[model samples]
Target: MSVLERFSFNHATAKFWDQREAVEACARTGSGIGLWREPVQEMGVEASAKLVQDAGVQVTSLCRAGFFTDPTPAAIDDNRRAIDEAAALGAPSLVLVSGPIPEGGTIDSAREGVKEALAVLAPYALERGVTLAIEPLHPMFASDRCVVTTLNEALDLAAPFTAEAVGVVVDTYHIWWDPEVWRGIARAATEGRIASFQLADWITPLPAGVLTGRGQLGDGCIDLKRYQETVDATGFGGPIEVELFNDALWARPGAEVFAETRAAFANALA
Candidate 1:
């Protein structure tokens, strides 16, 4: 596929963009989309599914559905709901962010919560034809965010289950700085565990809280082209979703942001 054809825009890139408009833009551009649960729920799951289906826009993956570090019964129930939503929307992957370290819990204990949660949900996800794609955040987020901080760690977590049920997200913004990232990519491919591939640049002077600080393509030090090339080398032919969490991009009109992000992706890859 050409660059535009291979692109999938994650809705968080333009946080306030109307879900309908984002779906329409992806349809018009022949691109895919990564949807978040809130907007999908706002429109209602069935309506959201119909919107994408009618537009012929592939929902590459759902934004999130994991925070089971504490793994309460409520967490499991919510994840089951997320799996159902992904199936209804025909999205192949549901992104999983292992939640923060619980009070009176160590990182190791929190990781075990993830494993326990996955063991419970993996079968359900597989039954629903959704892959639970675990996304490792930057180490900065280790305490209050994702405890899984490396692709290798994500892979280890996924190893207990079949790739069809659970897998890892190779997101550049989070793992670009890891020296062993290439090895992690290769290993993921070898194990058939790369369920989702996302792109975002890493720029300095992270915004307050650093949550919405992901830079646009070509705006940071990440070698976007090389990262794509490396993943492609593993023979994982799948949608490449550009998932930016940038305040500036979110402030613009959705359509404009969509167009600009697509161009930026192509140019950065070029």
Candidate 2:
């Protein structure tokens, strides 16, 4: 099969897409899908799971379930629900975006909070057979978005746990600028910690808030093909998820955006 055969589209790439339609599209193309919690909850987790099951679409990973930079009982409970949802959907991984630095807290303290939260939740995830994939967002988002900003840092956070229970997400848009990314990928592979692989280009002149500015595949400066090769070289055989958070793409029809994203993914790999 072609390399693109393993490409999976993250539903958040087209943020407003009907979940069922996106799942159906993946089924049609024989591709996998990465789902988000809001939409899945809107449809009800069990209903969402049944939809993907009926469509024969593989749920590659759940979009997120980690804001426990300052873990609370509620935070831990919420992630447990997320893990349950992932298990119900047959998704092997639950992607995590470590929450921002807490009020009056330093980044260092926030990272410690993440470790504590993981210590509490990792066993829960392990029990349910879901891997918690810590996603290191770009440095630009460190203060207000995710505290984890490097693969190495994420790996260190995951180091205390078994590979099956905790891992890291290697997304091009997030870590492409890290000088040690190649080495990080290698280490992640050696440790069996690569749970999710996503593609999103790094574009400049980011929009306000910078949350919705993720560029489409091949549209920006990231060497996506190189990332694919590097990850493959490391023996990571998981789905390569295309996950652009661009407003322009979201404003279009979901099916149209899905088609374009899939084409861009195939071209990037080609």
Candidate 3:
């Protein structure tokens, strides 16, 4: 396949502000999309699935599941439902955020929660033909978003499961600064743990909540093409997804944001 075949845009790059427009844009661009659960639910999963299916667009991965850092039975049930949604939407992977440290809990304790949650939900996801892509959120988000902070950590957590059921999401914005990133990528590939590949440039002056500050493709310091080359060298051959959480992009019209992001993604590859 051509390099274009490797390109994809996470709908979250458009910030979930407009669901229909985002899907339409992905269809028009012939790009794959990574969708979030809330918007999919709001639009109705079947309806959203039909929209993408009719548009001839691939849903690379569903934005999230696995926030059960507390490992409650209810949380595992919720993740099982997410797996069903992903299957219904024809999403190949279900991105797992692994959630944050629960209230009055330490990061270590929260990580244990993640392991237990995964053990509970991984089988269900496998049965549904969905891979759980454990995403290592930036360390800045360790307290409130995800306890998984490194690709290596994610892989270690997934070691007990089959690759078809558990794997990791390599997102530049989160793991770029890690000294072991390259090794992590190589190890992930060698171990058959590369469930998803995503990109976002790193920007400074992080916004409050640090949730919406992800940089556009070429706007920050990440060496994106190098990552693509490395992963491709490993024969991963999966969608190269762009997932940005930027307020500026979210504030713009979805059409414009989509166009601009496509251009930036191509330039990053160049």
Give each model's whole-structure lDDT. Answer: 0.94, 0.93, 0.88
- Model 3, global lDDT: 0.88
Q: How accurate is candidate 1 locally (lDDT)?
A: 0.94
Give the higher-lDDT candidate: 1 or 2.
1
Higher-scoring candidate on TM-score, 2 or 3? 2
lDDT of 1 by residue, 139-181 (tens): 9999998999999999999998999999999999999999999
List model 3 lDDT by residue over 194-221, tens digit each.
Answer: 9899989887766674688888888888
lDDT (tens digit, per residue) of candidate 2 on 1-270:
687789898999889989888998999999999999999999999999999999989899998899998888999999999999999999999999999999999999999999999999999999999999999999988998899999999999999999999999999999999999999999999999999999998888777747888988888999999999899988877789988888888899999999998999989889
Query: Over all chains combined, what TM-score does candidate 1 have?
Result: 0.98
What are the RMSD figures for all models against the true structure?
Answer: 0.8, 0.8, 1.3
Best candidate per lDDT, number? 1
Q: Score residue 159 of candidate 3 by CA lDDT.
A: 97
Q: Worst 10-residue stretch by lDDT in candidate 3? A: 202-211
Clashes of each: 0, 0, 0
Please give the distance, in angstroms, between residue 129's alpha carbon in candidate 1 and its true position after superposition.
0.7
